[model samples]
Each structure stands twice: as structure tokens, then as C-alpha cells.
Target: MEYGYYPGCSLIGSAHRLNSTTKKIFKRFGHDLKEIPDWHCCGAFEYGNKNELTDFSKSNLKKAHGFCNDIVAPCPACYKNLKEANQDDGGSFSILHPLDVFEYFDIVESIDIKHDLEGRLFTPYYGCVLLRPKETAIKNKDIMENFITRFGGDVDGEKVKDRCCGGNQFFINRWATEKLSRLIIDNTHGDLVVFCPLCHMALKTFSENRKVIYFNDLLLYVMGETDKL
Candidate 1:
């Protein structure tokens, strides 16, 4: 199976680990992820301006569609923007997150789980961008929880899964971002917190007690490819 891959801006910067691990796991699953040629940023959160956001998103979508109809982004922010752009443009192309692509291909059932996390506790953090507006959000939260369990990690139910991480306000208002991050950390009752790149970044900064990791990192560990990550 093959799909158009959009790394987005974060992948090269804060989310480089996610970029490398996702490619490694995809290949192990017998899937090919050809990067969309000349892809641009997904414009993160739009703030209060829609025109500039639409223009930036549309431009990136145009490049992605030029490569393939199915484009998968690893970052939730990128996925949301790409999905919204595709919908607004009435394009036939499909925009999906890396998790969605994995689910579509049913990669979990075939996983070997070389390194099970049986004794560990994990909190699946959704942050904000991943599940907002309903339409673009990940439809099956259980799939992620099940993935954790399949790899031998116990999903903690006490953690607030859909809390906002204040990623958009991180630069604008440090206080708000820290406040939200604290709320998530305070509520979490796990040894480790697993989530997307943005959430991982925010939560890790404010969290001193628990380890925070991207879900891709955990998946790589399960595949026994942690050395590469």
C-alpha cells in the first residue's frame, strides 16, 4: 500500500522523532509513504484570521493533491488543516492522520509486539486539534486505547483525554499554556503520558513527575526499533 506523506513544518523541527519513527513503522507494515513534492506548512491554528489561513492551507493542499489523492499527515494540527482545506475546496482527495492511515490498513492486528509494555501505565492524551469540530477528529478513540493495550500498556482512565493543551496560545500567552498543561498533568495518573507531538511538547515542559512521549515513540518501542528512534 502507498500514500502521499506530508511531513509538515513541525516534523522537521520539534517533531523530528515522530517523522523518523512513523516512516520506520510504515515500512515495517509493508506500506510506502511517498512524500508530497514541495509541500508547505499547514498553518497550524488559524488564530483569528481565516483568509491567510485558507490561502496557506490551500496552497499546501494543491501540492499534496498533485502527488496523490490520499495524503496522510503525522501531526494532528496538520491533519486538521489539510482535512479542512480539502473539504472547503470540494476536492476528491482524502486527508488523513497517520493513525487513521494505520487503522485503514489494519496494522495493529498484524503487529508482532516484540516489546510489550505490560506493567506500564499510559495516559492517552488527545490535546485539542485532534478531536475538534467533530468532522475532522479521530472517530475511534478506542483504536488508540486498544493499540496501547495490544502493546501491553494499561490505559489509565483517570486522565482527561480531550483536554486542551493551549498550543496555539503557547507563544501568545505563556500563562494560559502553562495553566492548561498543569491541568492535564495534575489529572494524569499514569507513569507515562502518550500523545501527539504538540501535546507532548507542551505537557513535557510543564510536567516534572511523569515522562511524556509521542505515540510514535511507543509504537517504535513495541516494534523493537527503539534504537532507530
Candidate 2:
């Protein structure tokens, strides 16, 4: 019923829609998401490059455990990082994505019945770090596909769909990312739908009909039509 919410840096800052829509859906599920007090950024992906993995995990684990054992992260980067921390520290806490929270409560009130993506042709985009550490139980591609299907969307299975979106990689090697992005677009051959902000930003430049959207935005659009919380 209650969990410690971690909005991450992107969602709290650039992704305003994510934070607002998340809170709205939480309320609909009768769940309280109290933000971790004095929370710090999860240091999305690149943090471990500088700091020791164990040390970074310890620092974040302290901040998270101080709040609660049930940690819910809205951003894929944050979710992967927090989950990694919990495992590395040998902590008992369980980290879950916000969508998992929504699904757990069976809260459909926040989504509009008519706005479902039943017949839409959409491709999932998983940026770097979404399913990190390479050993976690969660797979970004699978999770996003499950979430899409729950909301009524057809996932393209013609070929391998669980590939990177060439997002952060673009920052360093534009050529590699361009090649990757082109392959991804060519494979999907339609509009791409994704949850990661970085992925959305990257694909926007290459994909002409780029329809990058936060999964939370879709929920918000549906929620707007429902009775206010």
C-alpha cells in the first residue's frame, strides 16, 4: 500500500510529465508513494565508471534503506541502479518499477478505456542501463513488451526486437549509434514507442515520424479523461 518513491533526476527535472502522472496513478491505486527524504541522484549508468561499484552501492543503499524497504523507481536507469544496489549490498529490500506498482493493485481507473493502444504498430526502445549488471532478473525488453501488451499494443516479433536504441552510446560514437539507430528503425519499420527519455531523445533525430512518448504520458492522457483524484 505504501512504498518509497524514487523519481530519479530526469523524471524530476526534464520529465515533469512522469512525476505528475506517476503520482496520479498511485493515488488511483490507493497507494502512497512518499519520496525518499533528501534523496540523491541514482547517478544514471556512468557513476560506477568513477566510483567503486561496492562503494556507490553502499551509499545509495544507505539512502534507500533509510526511507523504506520497498523502493519504487519510475525511471529505467534509476530502477536498474537501485536494484543493483540492493543486490550488491545483500539487502533484503526489493526494488520495483512504478508500472509494477500499478499492475500490482489492478488499478485501471487511471487509464482511459477508449484510449487503449489495441491496434497500434509500435516498437519498444530500451536505452542503455535499463537492464544492467547483466545478471538481474529483469529484462528491459521483456518488461516494456509486457507493459505495452497490458495496455493493448502489438509488439513486433518479426525479428529480434530486444536491441539497444543507441542512446547514450551516441554521445561518444555518433557513427556507431547512427548505424544502430538505422538498423533499429529498419527492423521495426514503423513508429517507435518507448519509456526512456534518453532513448526518446536519441531516436527523435533519426526517425522521421518519431513519436517518442513516455509510458506515463499515455497513462496521464487516459487519466485526464477519468474523474480527478
Candidate 3:
């Protein structure tokens, strides 16, 4: 399977690990993630609220349209913004999340686990952008849980997985964002919290003692591709 990939701004910086692991895993699973040319930020989380007419996301979709009709974004905020742009422009391209592509290829069933997690507890956090507004939501709970179990990790079903990490407010009000991160960290029952890049940053920032890792990083560790990210 092949699709145009949009890494967004975070992928090159805070989420670099996610970018590397995602590309590696996709190649290992016989999928190609070709990056879109002239791709820019998808207006991320704050851009949408700041200006509705500018539509920075349209520039990305327009560039992606030159390459392919389908685009996959690893970041939830990017995925949402791109989807919104496609909708507004009435473009033929389909915006997809990474989980959507994984499901399309049935990635979990196709790969063999070289290492097991030894039943370590993990809590999955689906930040706001991934699940809000219903239409753009990826609905990846079952797939994520199945992936964790296949790697021998037990998904903590008790934790509220859909809570927001207060990513947007992180810059506006640091104290409130830290409080929200604390709430998530305090309630999680696991050896480490597994989530997308933004949530990983929030959880990691507020809780110095707790372990927070990206889902792809955890998968890479389970695959024995690297030692403890």
C-alpha cells in the first residue's frame, strides 16, 4: 500500500521519534509513506481558531493533490485540519489518520512480534483532536487494544482514554495545562502511558516521575527494533 504522508510541524521536532518509527514500521509492513512535496503546517490546533479565511491547510492539500488522491497524517491535529480543508474545498482527496492506514493494511495481523511486553500495563490516551466532532474521529480503540495485546502488553481498560491533554491551552495557560496533565497522570494505571505525540509531551512535561511514550515508540520496542525508547 502507498499513500502521500504529511508529517506536520511537530514530526520534525518534538515528534521526531514518532516520525522515524512510523516510517520504519510502515516499510517493514510492506507499505510506502511517500512525503508530499511543498507541504506546510496544516494550521495545527491554534491556526483554525485564529483565522478561518487564510486556510493554511488548503495549501497542503493542494500540494498533496498534485501527488496522490489520498493523504495520511500521523498527527491528529494535522489529520483534522487536512480533513476540514478537503471538506471545504470539495477536493477528491481523502484525508486519513495513520491508524486508518494501519487498519486498511491489517498491520496487526500481518506482522510477527519479535519481543513481548510481558503483560506490562499501558494506558491509551486519545487526545481531543483524534476523537472530537465525531466525523473526523478515527475510532481506533479496538485496533489499539488489539495491537497492545499482540505485543503482550495489557491495555488498562479502567482509565478514561478519551480525555483531553490540554494541548491548545499549554501555551495560553501553563498552570491549567499542567493541572489537566496531572489529572490524566494521576488517574492512569500503568507502567507507562501510551498516546500520540502531543499527549506524550503534555504527560511527560507535567509528570516528571511517570513514564509517557508514543504508541509507535512502544510498538518499536515490542518489535525489538530498539532498546527502551
Candidate 1 per-residue C-alpha lDDT over 1-229 given as tens digits, one digit per residue, 9 for 90 to 100: 7889988898888889888988888888888899988877777875568777877778887776557778878888888888888889996778878777778777788777778888888888877777787989976666678788887788874447887877667788989989988888887767544547777777888888788877778787787877432
**Superposed Cα deviation of residue 37, candidate 2 (Å):** 1.7
Ranking by lDDT: 1, 3, 2
Give the clash count for each candidate: 1, 0, 0
CA lDDT of 126 in candidate 3? 77
Per-residue CA lDDT of model 3 for 1-229, tens digit only, reads 7889999888989899889888998887877888998787766665436455237888887787668878888888888878877887886888888787778777777666777887588877776777787878886655677777777788773456777778678888988889888888888767554547778777888887777777787767767787775
Runs off by more than 4 Å, candidate 1:
157-159, 227-229
Name the runs in model 3 displaced over 4 angstroms: 48-54
Clashing pairs in 2: none
**lDDT of model 3, residue 47:** 44
lDDT of 1: 0.78
Best by TM-score: 1
Cα lDDT of model 2 by residue, 111-151, tens digit: 44646666776666655555554755343346556656777
- The TM-scores, one per candidate, come to 0.92, 0.79, 0.91
Off by over 4 Å in 2: 48-54, 106-112, 132-134, 137-152, 157-160, 222-229
User: What is candidate 1's CA lDDT for residue 177?
Assistant: 88
